[model samples]
Structure formats: structure tokens, C-alpha cells
Target: MTASTAQQVVYDPYSAAFKDDPWPVYRRLRDEAPVYHSQKWGFWALSRFEDVRAAARDHETYLSFEGIDIDDTAKDMSAPGFLPDIDNPRHDQLRRIVQRTFVPRTIAKLEDDVRRVVTGLVDRFADTGTADIAQDLAWPIPYAVFFDVLGLPTTGSDREDLVRWSHGLKDREDDDPRLTPVAWDALHDTKDYLAHVLTERRAHPREDLLSTLVTAEVDDHDGVPYAPARIDRDSEIVGLAFVLFLAGVESTSALLSTAFRELARHPEQAAGLVADPAGIPAAVEEALRFDAPLQVAGRTTTRDVELHGVTIPAGERVFLVYGSANRDERQFDDPDRFDVTRPPQRHMSFSEGLHGCLGAPLARLEARVALEVALPRLGRFEISGPLTRYRSTPNMRVLDSLPVSFTPSGRTS
Candidate 1:
């Protein structure tokens, strides 16, 4: 065994340095302490692919009951945020109610709309040959798609409110009450608005997804017929909506941004993708593997468990470092290298087991469609100015701003 360097290094997820470049720290943790214990945060972290996958699959032992975020006081576990927090059979129940809505076929129906949105977004800034892809294109695709699916009014301040609340929910700072309070407020405000929409849907059910949710029914453990209207009695229904908005918008946006940023830096790779649009799918997959959008997933041990010879006590917090796991040397060959044509392998980016991200299909679709449209329009682009990252949150690899200049292709889809 290698000499322990655990004492010489600290793994602080919130630190600016970690946010900027976490691979080195991740590499050290995987080597020296696969089951890393952070004294400051009072949690155990697993960076290896096998360990994180096992823990994610074994939900009974490593539970998400407390919350999925790193902060102990992060009350996303309460009310509408419970989708990510709750365990089965309740989690299964909630997931089942809305499962059909996000199926591949259902999501497939959005391809035309996705292309329209993507092309329009790209064309909006194509004339100038200069744009922040993150702001202009990446963020709006998922935001518009999700809004349209939910049957929400996707115009003006109402749409802006949805986007604001979606981000506010995730961007909060636990140490600073000022930063976190707005997130709490966004949660409450969005829930209230969703409730209003639910009431309106109840009175006049429509073809929209929210109406389907409001009117959907399922069977309980005892085989009793669960009331469809029971959605009105609790925040669980609203929580489901809240999660769809949060996950759909935030993660996918960050993903598109990161993928494009990488493509811009590696123009040769981007040229290859542009030359053969067929490679865009592989590129998107590589992007997910290369720079995962959401990095860490939280869990709590139900009982004492040993990992890498270290016994973590029952009820202790555990973080499944997906970002680290994706880059683990033992997992992928030349894991750090972003190869578009790497043979497809399962990655922890979308997580694993039953609690995996519900919006994975849609996220993939949004990314592929956006890249297909935008990359061609972008021609050959490069970063025009200093790139900035969103550092308010520790769980995601988000680009705050990515400035770029490109030669307009004058292409129309």
C-alpha cells in the first residue's frame, strides 16, 4: 500500500480552488483515501466508480432520506424537494406517477420543438458572430422545453420567474442566510404558483403535463385505489413539479454550457463534430463523461458500513463524488482525455439504480439537439474573454459566463 498522504491534504468542496479544478484533489482522494473523511464537513466521501455505484444502488443502507445536497441544514428534503430526499416505497410511487411523461417516446415527441428552439436561439445571436453561448442558447433550450411541457405560460416575467426560482433553489449558499433565504422564498413562491396551476387544471383539465399529474392515479401498498385528487392535499405533487423544473433547467443548461466550452477550447474536436454531425451524439456523451454537470450526490448510512477498511458509523453522511468517479483511472481508460469516440460505458453522471436522475432522457435530447444546431452555426469559435464559473454552489460544474467569437456560417435549419 502507498504511504498515506491523508494528513497532508484537505478536500473542501466549497473552496474556490476546488470549484476551479477539482480533478487533482479527486485524484488524491481516489489514490490515498478512497473512502475520504472530511473533518471539517463531518462526512465520508467515495470517489471510486465501483464504490459510488454500489452505494447509489444500495439505497436501503446509504439512504437519501436526509437530503441530496451537501449542507446539513439544506431543507430541500422538506415538502416539494422531497423527490430527491425520500426513499422507497414513496419515492417509487412519486416516480411512477410521472414516469410516462418523460419516457423516451414522449421525450422523442419534443425533437422538432427542440430543434426549432435551438435553431432560433442560435440564429438570434448568429448575426453578431459573438455571444455567450451559456446565456443565449444553452440555458433557454431546457427552460423553454420544460415550461412548455408543464403547460405553464412561457412568456414575459412569468417565464423569468420560473427560471429565477429554478436556479434560486440550487444556487443558495448554506453559510450565508442572505443567499439561502431567496432560495427558500423561490421554493415557496413556485409551490404556491404550481398550486394555483393545479387548481386551474382541476377545473379544466387540458393536454398539458401538469393536468395529467393533477389527474393521475395509482395503487397503494394494500392495493387500495389511491385518489387522483389526493395531489391537492399535500406538497408531494408540487414537489414533483418543483423537481422537474429544477433538474430539467439547471443540470441540462450547465451541461450544454460545459460541452460547448470544451468544444470551443478544442477547435479540432469541434471541427470533427461539425464536419460529421453524426459524431455530435458521441460528443455529447463524452461531454457528460468529461465534465459532469452535477458532480456530488448525498446519502446517509442507515447502519455502520466499512469502506476501504474504514468503518463509517450508522447515520453518518456520505457523498458519492460522481465527478471524481467519472475521472477515476480504474474506471475509464485515459479517463481525463476527452475522446468523442470512446466506446460507450455506463457513467455515474446520471447516477445509477432506482434513484437516478428522472430527466436523463430529456437532458440528453436537449444537449444533442442544441449541439447539432449550434456547433454548425458557430463554425470555428474560440473563447473571447476570461471564462467565469458559478461558484455559489458546490454540487454542480456550472459556467457563469463563457464569451466566444465565431465566424457566422449563415446556415438555416
Candidate 2:
């Protein structure tokens, strides 16, 4: 609104040559227009930490309704994971139901299980000398952990299908049509599995995430109890499950990969983290802020509102670029350089408001334990192989192969 602020803003996120690396542009947006509308995509992007934080808190103003992008595919498939893509009353109930399963105590209980899984993956790959961090370590940890949490009966079939579908969705191929009939078939099979699980829950409830959903009581806005809505037989639970697996693998793995990528680039920073193990949290925060896993989240405005002097009209679709905001100069000092000691500025990695990720605490736990286990075992891990980026990805400053060589601390007597 002010001339000084106007001087600090820029509109086009895709305009960055480093659109892949858009922090410099986000720096401008946060300084100038904390809430910026982009004409190119015909949407808005929130850049400032405060605005992003506030936007996250109030679900009423900015709704966490379902996404319609690739509507043909997602429309029939938007299964809310008790994570609430709907408005308050419904989202509130759904969120409450799901929240019950991921509490501190529940997650604390899961710590041993999660650690064992991560350690298992490390054990499998540690002796191999080197492996793709995403595929080998970061990806599978969350993939398996989510299944473990959701209480899915994974037969390895689910994972293979999920990875295939995730690749297809993330522009890994040409939307779903590339393998349309086949994609549909795989989705059908997964749905049948979930349906069987749901039915089993109906017959005999268990203490897992799906079972919770199966029996969750939906509280209407009028405070009346209603049976939880049936998960659509044809919904994107499988597709979204794929999203979660990819997210489990991609995002956390990205953090791990990028953390190593950045640390190896600046051994001094990596060395500092190793020097005092407690510092790994700060280092993780820096990794989150400097290069978050999620690049953007899409929303459709229901009413006309102005943010940072930019008017976002009702019915316009916009992307809240979390990756861009993480590097806002107004919020983070030395916006580009990865500084481990930097005070933890609020970031949009898991997003802020109503739609903020339900898996937040779990993802945080996994990543922390991962780095805790990784950095120590890594004993001066260095990128020692060909580096590549995830193809056709919209977010995540990720690498395909983060090859590293750490002093092998093996066979301790």
C-alpha cells in the first residue's frame, strides 16, 4: 500500500529464472506486498510470516475447502483425512477426530516404532556405502510410518501402487491419462482394500486412524451428532494416500537431502550441527525455512478481499507459495544463506492456517530423529555422487540423488 512497500514487491512467481529457487522473488513480495495477487496464475500468494501465520489461524476467512485442480481426477477423489478440507464446523469435527490419534502421547508412543523403522532403513542402506537418500532413506521412513500410523495393512503392493500414482500426479507423466485405464484399475484395487478395512472396522473397530474415521461422530454446526460421512468409494484417498507417501518420502526426504546438500556445501554449518547435537533442531529449522518441501498451496477465494493492497476477487484461484515466503527478507535475515543458528522464524512448510498439515508433529518427529540418527552416523557426510532434481515437481528444492560418504562407524566391539 505504501510507496516504500510498493517498491519492495513483485508479482510473478513463475517469472523467477530460478522459479525452481524463488526465494529472491519471495524476498521482494514479503517486503512489499505480504499478500500479493498474481495475474499470471490469476491467484494470490502470501509472503510475510505474520500474514501466513494469521491466514493459517482463521479458517473462516480463508477456507480449507477441497481442491478442484485437475478436477477431472481430484473432484471424484478428494478424500479428507480427518484433515478437513471443508469449512469450520465440519473441518472442526474431522480435525478433532483425527487429532485424537496424533496427540503428543500417541506420537510419543510411536517414537520407538518410528525410530526403529528409520534405523532399519539406515541399517539396510548404511553398509551399502551409498544410496539415493530420497528413495532409500527419507522416502520410505515416512511412507512406512504413515502406514504404521494409519493402520493400513501394507503388503508392499500399496507402496508400489502409491509411488506409481504419485509420480503420475506430480506431472511425473502426463496427468493420469498417460496410464488412465491402468491408473483407474490400481485406484480401484486400493479402494477395495480400504473398503475391506473400513468394513472390518464396522464389524470390529480397532485403534488405528482408519478405524477412528470409520466410527467418528460428525458434529453438525447445530451441535447435533451425525454419523461420519462415508468415504467415497471412488474418492482420491488412494491418490491422496499417494500424495502422503510422496510427501512422506519427498518432503521429509527433501529436508534430509537438502540439509545434507546445504551442509555439504558449507561444511562449517554441518560441522557446527555435529559439534553440539542440540543444534540440529536449529539446523532443521533453517532447512525448513531456507528451502521448504512444499512449494505452494492452492486456494479459491469465496469473497473479495485485499491483502497487502492486492485485491483477490472471489472465485479466483491462487497459490500460497510457502517456499517463496520462507526466504522473505522481511522475516528471515540473510534470506538466502542457510544459517543454522538463525532464530526459528515461522515458516509455511507444513502451511499455517486451517489446512495446516495434520501430520505436522509426526513429520517433525521423523525429521528430527532422522537428522539425529543421520548426522551422527554421517560422520562428515559429503555429497559424493551425481546430483539430480526431482523431475516434474511443483515444490521441494529436492535432489534426486544425494550421494554421501561418511566415515563408517561400523562393527563397534
Candidate 3:
């Protein structure tokens, strides 16, 4: 083990001040204590760009089985590990199944579907002159896309149920009731709801992710599989769905909100996309890196590790502040400035290496088409009301509400 550092670092991710905007504190931590140790959380932290990138990249040393939520309880830990956390052979098998549904070829088939959905939201709001972007537009896109891909209904109470549950999971410790063990109740219910979906897919397997997983086979890493044709675990299926639904809704919606906010704040940038639709994809990438939906992620140390000469003991959690790292001057030039043409630099927004976001391409495509389709059609829109930022979890930077004014294209010209 490397020598332990003298300075104790305290940056509770749950701290009230840190939630609203943590850049200043993160910047200080990067320079002051690159390997800050927090006894409050009983873990070590890596805030600098180099440290965070390295931690995320070295999945062998810093594994993600710990789960993303800083406040995860025994219940959460007890739940089956999802795509984001599972390691190796099993991960590869499950991923192959999940990927079948979300790959570009499959998603491209839904371009018309996405465009139709986008048009409906914009059209409804165009006549009304008001709509909450996060609620009405941003939040529903992914759910619509997900369910449509799965051959499920995109309407009814499940939409509302999922939305509330989604927000509940992201709230600040005090604000988001889901922060407590009480959230497990909701998690359990969500599990039940998703379980039904699994059963439905099993009974009537379709050409979707669940159906594919229902039929896919896994071989043991030790080659101990009784049969390669065995069915996947049902509990794992439901657990992965729960995670997928949440991941699909939360991060994409957050990114959408951020993208909309950026456009509203910088009409010129919005105009740039509107003028040349080709630029929207690049714009989305910059927005992703600039104000990432997932601003922080980490790994739990499997063994004692040395970070910048500071020893992080085994079995301790290490915070990898990608929100800070994304803006690191050392890694990105003019790191704070938001430019649409960022040349697709490898930012830690989706993280790196083994556990990086599996839905990256899908997310990027969603963002690109969303902004391209909506911004031009919704004539002149701006944040007409007080913006309500989503509750900050250690893992996400999201806006809860973005009330806006939007005029339709025909009505404008």
C-alpha cells in the first residue's frame, strides 16, 4: 500500500450546497486534494481529471458492483446487478441480448417513430403556447421510444407512474423521499410492474430485448453451464428492466433538458442547428460533455490502491467526479466554454472502459434527432418561467423543470 496522506477531505455528495452546483468545490478538490478521503462517507475520492479517468478505465481495480447511488442501502445492494455493474462473461452475454434491441440498426427503424412523437409534443404545445419541456417533451421521448421498441403501450398511467418514480430516485436526500430505505418499497413495486412485462414477453416473445433475453443462453465463465440454451434468470431480467427503464428515462431526459436549456440560453447556437441540421449531432455531443446528464460515477476499490501517492484501502468506495473532470483544463481546452463543435473528444461523461454507458450511441442519436426536430419546428422558445433544477444525486446533473414559450413554425412565419 502507498503512504496515506495527512489531509482529510470532506465533500459529502449529499451536502446541500454541493447539490445545486458543485463545480467550484470540485475544482478546489482537484487542486487541493487530488486523492481526498472522506471519513463521513468512509471512502476516498478522486476529483482530478486524470484520477477519475484512470479509475473509470481500470475496471479490474475499481469495480462498479457498488451501484451508482451514493445513498444505496442494503436493499439496493441486494438487488441483482444490472448492465452497468455486472462484470465479464455474464455481462457479455446479457449485454449481447440487450444490445440487440438498442443497436443503431434497430433504433434507426424508429426514426419515423421518434419524429412522430416529437411532432405531437411540439404540435400540442404550439397551439397552447406553453408546456413544461422536462415534463411534457423531454421526459416522454425515451419512454415512448422504449415502449414502442418493445411493442408496449406508450400511454396510460404507467407513464405517469414511471415519471414520478424516476424523479423520486434523483431527488436530494431530503427532497427525494426515495433517498431513504422507503424507496425500496417503490423499487419493489417497480420490480413487480416490470416482472409482469417480463412474463408477458416470455409468454408471447416478440422481436424485442426482453424476448431476446428470454431466449438467449449463457455459458459459465468456468465452462460449467449445463446447457448454452438455458433461459436467463427472471429476477435478473426484471432487475435489468428496472435499471434500463430508469436509465432510459433519467439520463436521456436530463440530457434533453440540458440540451433545451442550452438552446434557450444561447439562441445563436439554437439558430446554428436550425440553419444547418447537420450540426445538431455535434451540438448534442458538446452539450453532453459540457453539462453531462451523468456528472459523476465511481468504482469501489477491490484492493488497496495508490492514487497520487495517497493510499485508498480495500473495500472502500472512491468517488470519480466526471462533472469536474469533464471541465478539467488539463484534459479539454477552454474546458468551461460550451462549443457545439467539440470534435468528439473522449469525455468522461459516459465514462470509459468496461462499465461506460452501453447506451451511448442510442443516447446520442436520441439527442440529435430530438433537438434537430424540435428546435426548428418550435419557432421561438425561451425559458419563460423559473427553472426548477432536478434534485442532484452524486451520479446525475439534471433539471426537473424547464417552463418555456414556444410558437409553431407556420404560426410564426
Candidate 4:
């Protein structure tokens, strides 16, 4: 990890090499160059735990107006209502619109519903003894739950179309930060779908979050007195729905699949969970820390900041490496090991501060319930097929497929 080796350390977030295994590069960055600059991508990165956490908390200095992805998809802020692209006082204003629905107490009420969904999914393959956990369990649970939360149509061709479009929105090219044509089509179609849903909700109001958003209002800060006004812009509303759908479905999917895959690798830990179901929550947290779904968060520095004798100029994109920071030895003991008994520690997987993930509570609940229900049924499971990574933006780390074989219970719930 000398300066020459550091210079040899090419950290390309979008490159296939980095995606295959980023931990080694992350280690090099943290050890040799704490504040590493990627000249090719024209962005600076902070890989250390403390640095990333501080930047995430300092929303003023490390502004998020540029969006959280290093890609061009949200850089210009063309996609209205993408929450990560918005800054306060508008950020806070918009967040308040749907924040209550995501609070722990509110999300807790959905436990039964989440469990039902998990049970249904797990039952589908429970008797078969072999299943692609990612496709069969991880991906669909969040889709069913979040779509229900939004009151979106989750049946027939409507659900099929939404799932297709959602997957399209996540498409990304290797070693490139630009959105693919398929992604663009998916983006347009999703917005169009949301627009149609919003219109329907307007015509026939429902008791769901989307209907609430249709009639929601916030202070119009552009005015002198800042009077309360209805959110008139359709793009803003659509943007809100879009981000929610994407984050809600994808992040949780990644979390669940990763947890299961790791558990298969560490059967002893899985055994620990089966012996004591209460440990499932801590296991979920450990999974998040060991391998975060969202790898990096992007921000723009409003002022020049000095770190590790490296100065990042004002108004440049900075990558807060959440995936790397979570594994930093400076923060966690034996950070590389996946120990279910590891002490509860704060990790940047869900991010931090004002712009922290709104759906984290729901994600945790889903993962916990998913493992709780699936593990007992999947006793002593082993990976049965080739593993594949999800083809997504550089900022994400998720499996596209995880096939597992286990002793079949010969019964379904």
C-alpha cells in the first residue's frame, strides 16, 4: 500500500473488475489514499468510515442537489421528485409529505402483512427443496409490499408491467456511468404509468399513500410569506413515486438476497439464527454491514474541503463510499468477517443524517421476517447454481440469482 501501489490502484466504480470484488480496492483506497480522486470519472471519493459518515451528515457542505448516483441519470436534476437530488428547505418539505407512513411505529403495523407475503413466497418453493432465492423470494417480497403500500396495481398485467419497468430502470452498462437506452425507455414508461395512476387516484381517491400524495401540500417557499400550497407539479409527484418504487423494491431485494447468500456460505451462522429466531434482526444488521446493497452515494461539495492532505475543490462530485466505509477496520473489529454475533454497530448501509433512507425500517422488517420464515424451512441449505450479479448502476451491489438446495419440508403454508 505504498504511494506507487496507490497510483497503481485504479478505482473505477463502473468497471467490471471493481464490481467483481471491490473490497480489495476499497482497502487500498482507505489505507493509501483516504481521499482518493478518480481523474477518469472526474470525482473525488472518501472511503474511510468517519469521513463518509461526516460527509453524509454535513448536508450543507456535502450537498446532495446533484443526486446520489455518479451516473448521468440524475446529475442534471431532470428527474423531478428524486428525493436524493433535492436539497432543503424543499427536501424537508417533500420528505414530510410521506415521512409518517415510514416511521417505525407505522411500518411496524405492516408486520403481519409482510409476514404473509414472505410466507406465501417461501411456500411456493418450500416443498420443491430447490429455489432461486433472489428471483423467488427476495425480489418479489418488496415488490408486493411496497406496491401495496403505494396502492399500485399488483395484479394481472399491471404488476407484470410495473416489475418489468422497474427492472429496466436499474439497467446499467459495465464501466460506464451513462444510462442505457433500455433504461431510458423504462424511465419514461414508469413516469407515464405513475402519471396514469395519479390521475386515477385524483378521480377516485383511496386510502393509500399515492392518493395522499396526490392531495398533499407543503409551504410554497418561493412566496414571501411561504403560504401552504398544494403540490401542483405532476413531475414532482411522479418523481416522488418513482424514487420510492425504485429504492423500496431494489434495495430491500439486494439486502434479502445478500443475507441469504451469505448465510448459505456460513451455515454455522444460519444455525445460530435457527436456534434463536430473535437473533435474526442482528443477523440482518450484520449482513448489511458485511455487504451493503448501495455501494456509494454521490454529493457535491459547496466548499473546498481538506482531508488527508488532499483538497477537493468546491462544486465537485464526491463519492461517499458507504460499502467501503462499512468494512473499515477503523470502525468495526474484524470488519471483513461476517459474524452474526458481532456487536450492534452503526453502519452506513442505510446512510445517515437528514437524507437517510426513508424505507429503512420497512427494509429491516422485511429482511428480518423473510429470514425468520425462510431459514427454518431451508435448513442446512447450500448454493445449488451459479451466482450472478445484478446488472445495475455502479452504486448498487446485488445478486441477480441465488439458487439454493435444501431438505424439503414436503409441506406448504
Candidate 5:
């Protein structure tokens, strides 16, 4: 843990090699530098479990007005209702507007709908001995379910445009933290579409989340004296829809695909789930900790702080490396191994504290039900084709193509 060793450890969030496998570098950061500063990106990183968790909880010290992504585009252009980019009073106000929708009880009520989506997708390929999990199952289920949750059209050109825009929003280059031209276009189009939806909802409110967003109100704490005000800002509503749609679809898809991919590698674990479908929920937690979808979250230090002999000045960007923290040996036993029966434990996959993922319950339900319905059908499946990682963003660890060869089974209801 000397300066020389620390210097040798290159922690690049935008590197192609790092994206392929970041664990080794993550380990080095935790052990050698603990508080890593990258001159290339002009940001500091916290790789250990305690440090990242602590930072996430200390929202006052680690302000989030700069958005959660380390890229320039997110920090510069973060709009209203981008929950991760807002600080409290306002953050809490906006979050409360939609919090009830994501509560466990509310999300649980959607199990039937979620299952219907999963079953339909599985039916399409369950009888076929070969299939791509990413395209055939992982990608479609979230898109269908989330779009339904928002009362958006789930078919035809509309769905196609949303899918395209989601991909475009994530487009980035290796060693570069700027959004690509495609990403910019995607962002604008997505906002435009959401704005249109909000306008429609204002004119004719429906029994949908978008309608609620357009009509919801909050206490105007930032205004002159406190008063109730309508949450009618077009940008805010659009931003809320944008984050919910993009994160809802992309993160869940990544989680589902990663779970299946890991199971394909460790057939014994897959057999465990096949034997007792009850263990599927635990399997989902393990998948999240084993390989988190979104890796790093950005924070700006509000006051000078010292950690492990490094003094980060106030107003500096800090990255809480959740992907690394989840695997910190200090927190979990045999952190590298994938075990569905690891006795449920807390992890940074969904983040922590005030900004914890609002859609977690829904994501977990979708993953558990998808596995329960699909695993038995995909008995002894093996990864048949070369696995390709998502090129959307360096922070995401998702399979773009996960072709599997399995024993064909008759379609199930």
C-alpha cells in the first residue's frame, strides 16, 4: 500500500479493459489507495464497503446536485425530477410524490401483470432449444411491465422509439466521459416525448403514473414562505418519466440477464434454484451483489474531508464505487463466489439511504418471478454463443447477447 503501488493501479471508469473486468483494479484500490484520485477525470473514488456506504448516507456532506453519473453530460444537463441530482427538502418533496407507487405492497399487487409478461416472453422461446436470453426474455419483460406501470403504449413504433432512446441515452466511449451525439439526440427526443405525454395527461388525466406526476403537488419549501404548489413543471415531469423509464428497463434487464448468465456458468447453482423455487429471491440478491448493474455513483464533497491519509477538498467530485464495495471481502465472506444461499445480506447494489433505488421492489419481483418461470424450462442450459457485454455505458455490466442452448420443454401456461 505504498505510493508506488497506488500509482501503478490505474482506475479508469471509461476504459474498455476496466469495463470488461473491474474487480482486480477495485481490489487494488481498496487495499492500496482506499481513497483513489484520478487526474484523468479529476475525481476521487471510494472503493471500500464502509466508505461508500457512509458517503451515501451522509447526504449533507456529500451533496448530489451534480447528478449521480461521473460523465460531464449528466452533471451539466441534469434536469428537474432527476431524483439523484437533487438535494433535500426538494428531493424528499419530489420523491414523496411517487413514493407510494413503489412501496412493497403496491409493487406486490402487480405480480400477476409481471408474471403475465414473463410467461408470454418465455412461451415464445421455451419450446426452442436455442435462444438469446438478453433479447428473448431479459429486455422485453421490463419494457412491457414498466411501460404498463406508466400507462404508456407497449407495442408498435412507440415502444420501438422508447427502446432506441434508452440505448442512445447510455451511449458512451471508452476513457471518455462525454455523451455521444446519439446520446444527445436520444436525450432530446426522450424529453420531447415525455413532455408530450405530460401535456396529454394535463388535458386528460388517466389512471396512470404519468397522470399523477403531472397533477401532483408538493410543499414549496424553496419558495418565499411555505405553500402547497402543483408539481406541474414540464421539465420535472419529463425528467421523472425519463429516469424511471430508462432505469426501470435497463437496470432490470441487466439484472435478469446477469442472473441467468451466472446460472449458466454455475449449473449447480441453477440446479439449486430448480430444486427449490423458493430460493429464487435469494438468488436475485446474490446476482445483484455478485455483479451490480450500475457501478459508480457520483457525489460532490461539501466540506474538506480526510480518509486514509487523503484529504479531498470541498466541492470535488467523488465516486462511490458500489460494484467494488459489494464485493469487498471485509463485508461478505467469499465475496467473489456466487451463492444463492448466502443468507440475505445488505449490499450497495441498489445504493443506500435517501437516494436508494425507488423501483427496487418491482425489480426484485420481476427477477424472482422470471427465474421461477424460466429456470426449470431452461434445464441445464449452457452459454452457447460468445457473450457480448453492453457498450451502452462503462458503468453498466450487462450482457448484450446471452445465447443459451437448453433442453426444449413444452410451452407452459
Candidate 6:
């Protein structure tokens, strides 16, 4: 349904229908209500590619210090503003400390490890004839890489707990009031785990990112000239770890699942990659654009602002829908169609600003390596059953299960 100024449509983030497929709603918002206001949720949204990108770039106007989610932004979680919740100066300082670690060069070094993880996952179901790629491959690969990258042990139930915490952090359920509390518990547990790990690593430093965080020093910004101070406080370190967990595991996992689902739907696209593995990079970009892993990003307006002839009042929460913006007709030629070989079009999938995804290089690297290894092995997998999407969180687009049937080569098994 095309929206027009004559008819105003309500956008409720809590609704399950909206969670299922937001493309239609996004299109209407872009065409009709460029600056859509949701009376039910009490928030404004910018769905157009240009509007969303502009809001993301102008961080001063669309501040992150107010928290990044409409629901969580209103609550007092009793925690210091983390990466997604903090603004510049502080954000730049904290991000720089970890930025060097996620550069392409650093991520490229993990190619072998990622391949190994992918190989191991595929081997488990290679002879079974059917596999839920989301569970069997996409899900485990990221957590495995995340644990390895942070120099944490890939043993016991710790990794499982991390996954749980990651999910809880993003899950949003308006029906069940307990959902938010449970999510907070998960967040706290993760922070506590990181604090414990920081203590152990600090006493016995190692060649890992966590250890680097333990020993790194930065300006205190206390006073003139600034005194040097360790940045590894339990509070600060947990925030850093939390952000990494979300980016490294949750979003990357979704990207892989979404990419494979698209591949199963479109054999020709997969054929191109199978024919030449070098084209895997382009496929990855297309996947990121087609079905962005991280869908909605939250921000708050610093003051009254006029957009698309509508004036938004001061201090109103806004959602910059990356999922919608990526599909905006103004941006891509055929927005809805998934074309791997589409011409170069910069997408807002990873966002575009100082607060843009820091783990983008690592995400692309992991997805590319996973595709390079799995696509050739699967030969031509077809969707054997219905795809189940996780609906607890409207912010993320992830599959709980994606069952596919493939003639297993049994080569690695």
C-alpha cells in the first residue's frame, strides 16, 4: 500500500507483523510519510535512505547518549553509556582502542581459522542429507570465532551463556513485561563474566585482545594535559566486550544465515560464486545489502528539527531504519530484488558515520570465508522446509532455523 499525506499510517515496532517483513511499511513511509510518527510507540522514524543516512551522520542532532533503543532508552539500567549508547569524544576514544584490532589486515589473518570452523560445522551434517544452516553452520561459526578472537576458552558452557546474553540484549517483547528484566539480567551476567576475565588476564597478561584491553592506557580527560590511566575498569571493559559480542556474534550470524537463505532461493546467484569463488566478496556485499543483519538503529533528536516539511519536537526518540533505507528506491535501482552482481551502490547496512559498525571488516571476512568454504561443498542446497525467524527482537533480523536439503559430498567427513 502506497502511503500518501492524505492517509497517515501507524508504525508500531512492537507488532509481530511489522517484525516479519517491514519492506512494505518502509516503502510507504518513504513515499508518503517520510518522517513518520508512531502515536502508539511515541517515536519518530526516518525511512528514506537519504534521511536515515543524514540522521546517522549528524550525530549531534541524533544523539546516542540517550540510549540506542526506544524501550531501553526510557529505562534507567544503572549502567554507564556503552558504545552504542555513548556519543563522540568518549566513543572515539573507546572505539580507537579496539579499532586497530578489527582492521581488514588483522581480520584476514583469521581466514584459516574461520575456514576450519566452517569445515567442522559442515562435516557434522555433510552425510545427513539435510541441515539447518542457521543452527549447524551460521550460528556456531561466529561464536567460535568470537571466543577465539578474544582469546577466551572455547570450552564449557561459557560460550553458550555468551550467546544467551547476546540474544537477551537484543530481544524485545512488549507482551511479556518480564522480557526486559530478563534481558537486563543477561546483560549484567555478561558484564560480570567480562570483569572476571579481565582480572584473570590482567594478572597474567597474554597475546589476546582481552589482555590488551587489560593493559591498555588512555588519557583520563580529568584535567589539563590529562593524566594517563588504565582503561580496563570493570564497568568500561564490560561495555567494550558487550558491543563486541553484539557485533561479532549476533549480527554476523544473521548475515550468514540471510545470505544462505537468499542463495537457496536464487540458484543463479549461488552458481556465479560456485563457478568462481573469487566472486564471493561481491555476494557477501549483496547479502549485506539485501537483508541487513542489524535492522533498526535508535537515536534521539537533540532538538526540534524539520524534516520532509514535518517538525519533530525536541528530545524525541527516532529510529533510523537501516533495513528500510537499504531497500529505498532512491538508493538502489531494484531495491527488493537480490542481485549479487549489482553495480556498486553504497549501502547503510553497516551504517555510515562515526558510530558505524566497527566490526564490519571482521563480519565481511567471516561471511566471505564461510561462503567460500560451504557453497562449493553444498553443491546446490534447496530450502527443504519453512524458515523460522526470531521474533523476540524487532531490532535484529535473524533466523532461528533455516532447514535446507543438500546432497552431501561427504568429502570432509
| Per-residue lDDT of model 3, residues 1-413, tens digit only | 22243253346676666777677777767777778877656767787788788888888888767766556532253356377767665567766657667767866777787888877777777677677889888877887887666545567788667656655554446323135544555566666776776666767888766566555555435443221232233377666666676677677888889888888888888887888889888888788778878776656888999766777888887878888888888888987788886777877888888777777777776777788778876656789998877764556777779998877556753
Output the worst ten-in-a-row residue range by lDDT, candidate 4: 224-233
Off by over 4 Å in 1: 1-4, 174-179, 220-234, 410-413
Per-prediction tally of clashes: 1, 5, 1, 0, 1, 0
Between 2 and 4, whose lDDT is larger? Answer: 4
Per-residue accuracy of model 1 over 73-94 as CA lDDT, tens digit each:
2454356436788888878877
Tens digits of per-residue lDDT, candidate 2, 299-380, equal 6666886775567777766566677767766677877888888876777788866777767778778877777776666666
What candidate 6 gets wrong by more than 4 Å, as runs, is: 1-7, 73-78, 174-178, 220-234, 410-413
What TM-score does structure 3 among the candidates reach?
A: 0.88
The TM-scores of all predictions, comma-separated, are 0.93, 0.81, 0.88, 0.95, 0.95, 0.91
What is the C-alpha local distance difference test score of each model? 0.80, 0.63, 0.71, 0.88, 0.86, 0.78
Candidate 4 whole-model C-alpha lDDT, 0 to 1: 0.88
Each model's RMSD to truth, in Å? Answer: 2.8, 4.5, 3.6, 2.9, 3.0, 3.3
- Pairs that collide in candidate 3 are 390-400
Off by over 4 Å in 5: 220-234, 410-413
Best model number under lDDT: 4
Off by over 4 Å in 2: 1-19, 28-37, 66-76, 79-84, 154-159, 166-189, 220-232, 235-249, 391-398, 410-413
Candidate 6 global CA lDDT score: 0.78
lDDT (Cα) of model 5:
0.86
**TM-score of predicted structure 2:** 0.81
Global fold similarity of model 5 (TM-score): 0.95
Model 3 spans with C-alpha error above 4 angstroms:
1-10, 73-78, 158-160, 168-172, 175-178, 220-234, 406-413
Better of 4 and 6 by TM-score: 4
lDDT of 6 by residue, 264-305 (tens): 999888988999988888889999998888788888888999
